[model samples]
Target: MDDCTDRATKRSFLAGLGSLGFIAFGTAAGRTSAATDSQNTDPQPGKGPFTDSDEPEAFVDDVMAERIGTTTPGATVAIVSGDTPSLTKGYGAADVDADVPVRADETVFRGGSVGKLVTFTAVMQGVEQGVLDLDTDVNSYLGDSTVTVPDTYDDPVTLRHLGTHTAGFESTLDPDIVADPAALDSLEALLTNQQPSRIRPPGELVGYSNYGAGLAGHVIAEAHDTTFEEYVQSEIFEPLGMTRSTFAQPVPDDQPGNLAAPHVRDGESFLVADDVYINMRPAGSLSATATDMAAFMSAHLGGGAVGDTRILDAETAETIHSRHHVRHPAVTNWRYGFHEYGNPDANLLGHSGATVKFTSYLLLALDHDIGIFVAYNGNPSEGPKAVVDEIVAEFDLQQAPTTPTPTWRSGGQERAETVAGEYSLTHLPQSGPLQVVDLLEHLTVEPADNGRLRTTILEGDGRQWVETVRVRGGGRARCPGLRGYRWRGGRAEYE
Candidate 1:
């Protein structure tokens, strides 16, 4: 309900773009809980709160209602319990100037980086058909294409690396956004011209890369000898019967769904604004309704199948959900295209997304067979992820009771001192004008009392960490307030 930033006219589009990069990295799925018993337990038909219930829908309704006009001009939400679509609803005004209300099945909202899931799903499809291999060098697929990965290191960039965000593409923080739709170029041209240098070896570290995702889509298209949009439309969306989803810019007016008008906050109200086109379409240019997204989630929860149609085999879907990259043993890691939601052990997977004026988030509780998707027409500090966090907590999805047990391990203070320093996220830009954002995102670690460590960001949001054990590179620590919230010592290194 609080204003995220100044409502100045100057802070409308570009200001939101500045935070888009960070929003992609936001983990609003659940609290870091150390509870082990229920984290891995699968939900039975009548054994849990989420499956076959109206409680989750009611909770989501309340959450969306509170955030509708204040946090975002309009929002749509979808929840899938087991194999059934439990809830699909909309809130607030879709086009404020026209006084149009959102309709979950008819109103389309830009999905931003959340579309990376669809792109990666296509990659998994290629893998299933034996047209592509995860570990195979990506250059092999671009045999006649204009884009090619430069051999910057001994290792070749592979589809696995791209899906896991370990392809090592240099960070630019911008997804080739253009004001005019006419300025958008072909996927191959965009990839070739804006190719980022590989700064790290493939599969080395988990640095988020929009280029990596875009290139994955291009590879899929080339392998199928078709365009990205066409392939997904015919292969993924069509098979799943998702008619309201498309990766096309401007969302073709003839399409059945009504595209939600973008909005900018203006002194407790919102004004309609123009939408920008993402040149790297596969990475962030999906426009879908909540109803269509429900089908997408149902397919994933059903192990790549929905009813009689199966886009991916059960084995392929399992592989996509399996861990593809590990940031640390204690913290969240990357699944094929999705990332670990809360506790790595919790088995929750999700992704957050943002465009200049829209924000969205998706989470799948594999253990509970529940999928939650939310999208907003306006990008605020508290966006769709905030709604996701509330739903996650209300349902006790990935969280556990916090009961602190102090450790008496030797050299605790010394280990804490070793991690004490100022650091920045690897995903943030290290070069270009966007590098300025890295300055503000620095996480400062300082040794606290009783061998605990304190982490404070430039925004002064401080979290306490208690050391549990020494790991390979450094030590592992968890927060006592929320048990099981652990992270590797060098989560952020000195900049």
Candidate 2:
């Protein structure tokens, strides 16, 4: 990866604190983060046949600059292809108070829910080795006669449900773990005390549950007769050659030097959060560098093989990316560990992670064998999805045939300002909030580049309520009500 200091001029964008602030925190089960040496190094170009050239670098620079100005004290981004990383850049200070700058390969941040992917991989390995079965009831492996499912759940919760978060288990870890770093050390006792619920029948619907993942990790530990941390280290990390990755509590002690401090917006400034540990290691407690994560992404993209090492068979890897169940029928595409973007014409699969202060995303183009990993040190007004969409567009890395870019007429700033407002989901009320949505009409907007007259809906509710609606073409905006509902897409709808 190239370490570049050629900074780009900052761009003015939306700003805020907490959920209103640019923090990216997903509630999924696993988490990961880190920092490294800084030396002036040339940007290493992508290994894939297609290269993004200067466009991607410029785009990345703009992103980092925005985060530095808005949320994080420092930020590190690593973009890689196949076996080699293309870009690794750092911006701002790693320690704001100490004024320590972030290094491309050195700075580490929380992994957030990305660690769940690793846990999922570990479970799959056990399944492949005949040590576990995906279809087998999880209670069989738990071997606890005292533990029983609620009578409400007619179907038994299996390993598959647990792995895919369909087991209906709910996480009960103390929320104060963010404030108390040592809380995670007593995870087993906590899990034992707080019996999770089977709110829904197993495999009935996809409801993300950290408890489900932690339970799966627990089951793996029991089946292998070892601590979950040790089992993951021995079976997954070591084999994958992730030298610096670990599930250690009180992070820096486990893997020193390369740790990225967590950041939270304090007033108009960004400050580091107290070092927090997760007792639910399986769901969100792994720390790794961008390079190490790139290796993991490469393995997944390469069908479970990083170079000559085959961590999983091609078939098993394929299973990991495939959609295990429909999460929300109206919510477009939601899959097992990842979500699908685009329709039958084009699709990309990946998952995004966020902690209190950091936002990260990993996207893979399965057909093209291309993948991208992005991690930011601080929060941004825009989420990581914006970064992913921009990179893919700037690089022309879509799996399907390319479509012609549409021409957009710039509507005056007044129109842009008029359309930009927070919108709530009436149908899916629980999906959180959306904010700063800019709507455009009859514009062939490319990814990464913002357009004018674009009526964008900043969903007050974070749920992606509008699916299958054309954002560019002139159609009725089918968005949920509460608006100057200008003509952009089709008429907006509630459900």
Candidate 3:
């Protein structure tokens, strides 16, 4: 049960998997024919669609071992582009004590909140079928009147709000719910019973709520006259050809050969999850391989058409990526389920998922017909962000910089007066200004190695708020907390 022994067992298991299947859909003739059909069309330059090269799998192994050597017993990773370009790889162990080796396509890691996208898709399908309206009051679909809505809200709670995390419902996955297994028996019970706190009124602000999405799932189940699990399986999973995906609690023991054991950090040790079944099933319960998830993303990147199957219309898929509502005053670019970046040139949309031991991220560029999906079966500290950043850079997938100025500030003396001022964070639209609460009297603005102004905010009481301000396009400075602020127009009001 020691950490080292546990890790070794997991590594051995992941390394012992047998041969894996790789499928190639289009033939040379088919590719040629498709290219010929689009001869008159000019395709834009894209970063990838990258095929896995024979770079020593050593690089990936080093990454996995170094990052999660202490916490995760084993791990796996799979990346895919369009139908033709793909890379499926695995490393580490499925279970440390069991000595199960992780297989690329075979290992089934918890999808976590990635399952929300599945539920979101199902809700959208209900919208398309007229069984559910995005803007309709959810009370109609609920069989019971246990859940209550605030009277101050003029607008009704719609399926759209649930998908976009704007339902204004408080999250019920608190300590009590986590402690009790049966607390998740019904969504209405969880919602109506949980105290109501009006967070910016429904649809006005976007705050992530597992309670809101699970409520939507319950509504969908009632509307279709079937269990939420069954409805999603038949309508979404089966149609998208995700044979391995499911919402079942604890996943079926006899179902698949590649089930990834969940892990958690216990002080200096990483142990298996104690309570795997919590109330966030609708928000985070899902399991699948990269191959299956790629199909889901393929359908999205392919304009809602994966091979011969079309689960959603192109327009509807586009709308899902569109900004429905803003989430936070500080993070204005976040909308609904997707995070919006203000750079007009880089129109990317996607969601990041984190569970007890896994972190997954999926991003797609509608204009470029490009998509990327990443899944890691370890803690977020296992370097998922670095891997994602590298992928984005490698593919050159990001939009062009809006501002042309180099990140470095030119030769200049540290000027406290020049930089000191009240600035508005304007990257994301806001109702009011973001005042710099304290600008140190003896503060200085200096150029960091990266072309940006580093302002040292010092207080007479010895407190400090150091901020790095990067110039984003249109004479706007990108400040971390304050977002994009006007650089020149606003005058400094000294305290």
> Best lDDT goes to which candidate?
1
Best by TM-score: 1
Predict model 2's lDDT versus the native. Answer: 0.56
Residues 296-397, candidate 1: write the lDDT tens digits.
998999998888878889999999999998655555667899987655677999888888788888999998888989998887766677688788888888
- For each candidate, C-alpha RMSD in Å? 8.0, 10.9, 13.1
Better of 1 and 2 by TM-score: 1
lDDT of 3 by residue, 57-161 (tens): 334444555544353555555444554324455555555546566665677776656677778877877777888888888877775556656655777777777
Q: Write the per-residue lDDT of candidate 2 for residues 363-471, one digit (tens) a residue.
A: 7777656676666665555656567777777666665433333334343233334334433221111222321222211112111223232222332212111112223
Error of 3 at 119 (Å): 1.2
Taking all chains together, each candidate's TM-score versus the true structure is: 0.86, 0.70, 0.67
Residue 289 of model 3 has an lDDT of 70
Model 2: residue 34 alpha-carbon error in angstroms:
16
Error of 1 at 76 (Å): 0.9
Looking at model 2, report the run of 10 residues with the lowest lDDT sum: 2-11
The true-versus-predicted C-alpha distance at residue 484 of model 3, in Å, is 12
